[model samples]
Target chain A: MTETSGFLTSNGMAIDLTDLTIDKAHKHLKSRDFSAMELADAYLEVIEKKNPEINAYLEIYDDVKKQAQQAQEIFESKEENIVTGIPLAIKDNILIKGKQASAASKILEGYTATYTATAAHKLIEKGAVFLGRANMDEFAMGSSTETSAFGVTKNPRDLSRVPGGSSGGSAAAVAMGGALAALGSDTGGSIRQPASFCGCIGLKPTYGTVSRYGLMAMGSSLDVIGPITKTVADAEIIFKAICGKDKYDSTSISGSINAVSPKKEYIIGIPREILEIEGIDKDVKENFEASIKKFESLGFKTKEISLSNIAYALASYYILMPAEVSSNLARFDGVKYGLHKKGANLLEDYLNTRGEGFGVEARRRILLGTYVLSAGYYDAYYNKANDVRRLIADDFENVFKNVDIIITPTTPTPAFKIGEKVNDPLSMYLADIFTVTANIVGIPALSIPSGAVIREEKELPLGLQLMAPHRGEHSLFMVGSQFLGE
Target chain B: MITRTDIEKLASLARIRLSEKEKSLFPEEINSVLGYVEQIKNADASNAKALQKETVYNVMREDINPDESGVHTKDIVDEFPKKEGNYLKVKNIL
Candidate 1:
């Protein structure tokens, strides 16, 4: 799309997807300026060169050349919509018929899709190129991409550091310019945190806004599929295209983009309790203040809102999400079609497959979920957590009743080094504290790259988040885009 | 507060072989998290009946009746750790 049109090299290999925006490529191709095959060949060269270091993709669709040949005909005929043969990456959790939908897990290691995931189908119908399956956490269960049965996906910004997860590869691909835009499923900060860590924009549309029919289930109530893009506008455009009712997914909502608040000023609520956690990174706090100052400058009124249940969000999320994840993922045990190992009987095969398939982090959550939902402990844990989930939701509902939007740091800190917190599961889960509430309350939230913080060990961007009532994404987008100085 | 034994038992039930190294790390983590859940144990949830759990059902549509879901079996076989002719190769079952 840019002057460096052909394949280029980054991270020691050829990267064809870099600088490949939908707008630039289409404009040139439609005007008889360039051919689609040439563009595909250019990217193929790049992928061949740069894929070793960035390993963002799991399967590189070799037949893409044929698809490009077809698209070239359309471009020659002078018809190119918003996406016409634009190369894009789909997270492995979502199925694209005929492509392997492993979710990067060993159990379902090579399973191909019988039905294409809804979002991928829509993107394909619009002429978006399916580059390949991107790597992700096994079953979309962990925050860091490390949990992926596939090896870790490094941050394109800094090779040694992580890209963030469970949609880490999706964010890294977009950040490293490997893909124009990537569709990632976010549940408890998966999309937003990785985007922040990689210095890109991640939008978690209102729950049920995007269909999740084929997305590998993590927390069914919390999981949402949204785009991780370089700019908020691109994120908004992608959100608009894939959102709406789908017969395949009953969770899909009839969310309207037109419920945009036109007020010149908005009341923004900041809960002080969330900010008080120890080890809250200094740079994130500073960027948050500066971001708030900018919002105030834009005529937004700020208040320190008191919603007492904030302290318990992380606890409630761990309990409730794992319970849902445990139930949703129960079907993946060997017999149905994920992983199968030979055993003297069916039981050993099921146990071995799951044992080998899931990562430590995933195993921990599954165990916790199984415990909480077990017969004796149901009232003490799961039922009580659900009760608390209500309290947290009520807190947000009441807060939104008085204010138009709520803002917080999308994550407590920027991306830590690859192994910094992986050894400690609680610390890793705590990293999601700022984001878990949006899922718990079922509200729309957006995370925009606020500013970069360069620590001695690492330099990554911090995210300033804006949350709105359910179906209030337009306002969240407006405020987030406004804060990012769009 | 969840004890180390509780974390260990949960780990065992979940079937992840938590080495002593990890076992030591979780007691504190689980407790700190459960401490937060304890507060929610006291929230007024009389009206939370519907908001907490919604019964979900699969919406099955008329089959495409194409005999198969259209997935290639080759790709699926190739992804296993090890494989044989049209089969997944693994450790002996018996």
Candidate 2:
């Protein structure tokens, strides 16, 4: 036994899982430095200590030991995968059979998943240990997890601020070292934004790259499942494991991560007009600019580009996403599954169940969706938004012809105080201003932690977002790994 | 400006019951969001083809008799608020 005595611990346990990455964890398990049970215990100890204050995990899976035992068996049998014995946090939206998968909505309260998500199934197949279901924005509707019906997840770096959402809890779990990595579903910046706020690496693979068979439907076309990890290489490992076509998810494609013609002298495009928009914090902008300078120093060239229709991305995303939301969420009517409320009639039952089941933001979006897709307004709002979406995609296609990737700040600011923008729905919607474009265009994007800036005496980290063309996750990994010095 | 009547009409359309307070507050909130999204009307998409509907084709699989297979029937039936055998018991519509 190698002893595995190289971690900082407060309780004086022989092992500390906080600082161990997947590679190190797997190495230790293989070398018998520490048993997988010891690693799970270390994480459990920390989770027991810190989870209450942070509200990161909705449920710490009871099967942690069972899963670790299986992984330990795999390791002992010399059949270990990269993720074997590594604990991972799963976002609440992804279904894990026999476990409560609430999507942070009361409608799904006490609801157990019938079958496992393909992405999660793949990870479990590779011998990964699932820690628990992490909290999220209720139905992934909000940019901050304050909207979660389960309760807001406090940022680990600063208790007052949010960890970003709707994957806030997943990011927080990884950031606080409660889990080595996490699976986060991104629909308009949920993964990347939270990762940026929590000082971790988050990737949103191309729309069809990761199967969405069991992820709760947010915006069907735009939603994607990705990883949140401490390092880009770790993110890459999880992404490769989870991404590919699944028989259950028709939208899923057999993605090829290795197929990329890497640019000799990579050109990073900056839509200066979009960057010049107001509301971006000075410190955030300075940090972003510093990242750009660093990239330049590393021999990558920057070019000014114009995505003319990009200014309208946020507006377009809101319209289209809500439209999809209203349609996809129509499945949650009282009769079939989830919360059911009795009423005078079937219609009354639906109304009461939905109204009572859905939170404020969810109800608001459903109504907005109905209004936009309504008869008189369909051509004006819904159709126009779809066209503008195409125009946005066209802008990306036009730009990527010259540049290898597009770079922007993940969000306008770092972590903001919880309840800061809750009342102002428009302002809250703007939290994803920089991120919705990638989802709109169906391209892969990565948020790499650039550095931190002091906000209210707390060091809040900022991220630099790099967007690449469809099936261009390898390029993203290349640039991300280079930026992270992995 | 969206009136309270419009908000009520939208609630009815969406099949979501709303409180009297929500009926009053939602108009202002929904209008504000709609007002922000009204910018899409300015985009020149007259010639742009609607790819969101057309380009994305639904994937089809070889026919599998789900009813006979009883694959997810139990899981689906278990969620019904009122159930009898395999049927989801609902209020009499007829």
Error of 1 at A442 (Å): 1.5
- Using Cα atoms with residue i matched to residue i, what is each candidate's TM-score against the true structure? 0.86, 0.96
Candidate 2 per-residue C-alpha lDDT over B1-94 given as tens digits, one digit per residue, 9 for 90 to 100:
7889998998888888899988989899988999999988888886677434355666777787635677888886776778999998888786
User: lDDT of candidate 1 vs native?
Assistant: 0.76
C-alpha DockQ of every model = 0.29, 0.69
Residue by residue across A1-486, what tens digits does model 1's lDDT show? 112444432323333344545666666566545566666666565556656887778888877887777776666666666667666778999888777788888868778776688877887776677677787877777677878878988887777777888888888877766677888998898888888888888889888888998888889989999998877777877888788888878788774575655667778998767778877988788888888788799888998898877777777888899899777767776654666665665566666667677766676677668777888889978887777778788888889888888889988888878888776676788788888888888788888887787767556777888889888878877777777666
Off by over 4 Å in 2: A1-13, A16-18, B50-54, B66-68
Those runs of model 1 whose alpha carbons end farther than 4 Å from true positions after fitting are A1-21, A41-46, A77-79, B1-39, B42-94
Q: Please give, as one word, the docking class of candidate 2.
A: medium
lDDT of 2 by residue, A218-328 (tens): 899899999999888898899999998887888888846766677677788987787788799999888888988899988888998899899999999999999999998
* Candidate 2 chain A: 10-residue stretch with minimal lDDT: A1-10
